[model samples]
Target: MNNSLKTIAFISGIVILAYGVYTLFKPETQISIGDVDLIETQDNTNSYITIAVGIVIVALSSIIGKK
Candidate 1:
C-alpha cells in the first residue's frame, strides 16, 4: 500500500513538473491590465527556476512521502 501511494505521488510530481516545463516553453496569452497591455514572454530563466523548485519539491516528497 505504501509503495503504491509513493508511486502515485511520484507520478503526480512528474506531471506537475512536466506542466511547468510546458508552461515555460508555451507562449502565454496576453492580458490587459487597465490600459496597459501585459504580454508574458517565454522566460527560460524563470522556467528553469520553477523546474528546479518543482524538482526539489518532488525530491522532498519522495524522501518524506506526501505531507
Candidate 2:
C-alpha cells in the first residue's frame, strides 16, 4: 500500500511539473475592443516562478511520503 501510494504521488508530481512547464511556454492571446486593442501579457518569469514553487511542494510531499 505504501509503495503504491508513493508511486502515485511521484506520478502526480511529474504531471504537476509538466503542467508548470507547459504554462510557462503557452502563448497568451488578446482581443480588441472597439478602437482599443487589449493585450494579454504572459510573464514567463512569473510562470516559471510558480512552477518552481509547485516543484518545491512536490518535493516536500515526496520527502514526507518517504517517511
Question: Considering summed lDDT, which 10 consecutive residues are worst modelled in model 2?
Answer: 58-67
Give the per-residue lDDT of model 2 (tens digit) for 1-67.
Answer: 8767767766777777788899888878889889999889887886677678668757866786554
**Per-model TM against the reference:** 0.52, 0.59
Model 2 residue runs over 4 Å out of place are: 30-38, 43-50, 61-67
lDDT of 1 by residue, 1-67 (tens): 7777777767777777887798787867799989999886655887687678778767866886545
lDDT of each: 0.76, 0.76
Clashing pairs in 2: none
Give candidate 1 regions above 4 Å deviation: 28-53, 64-67
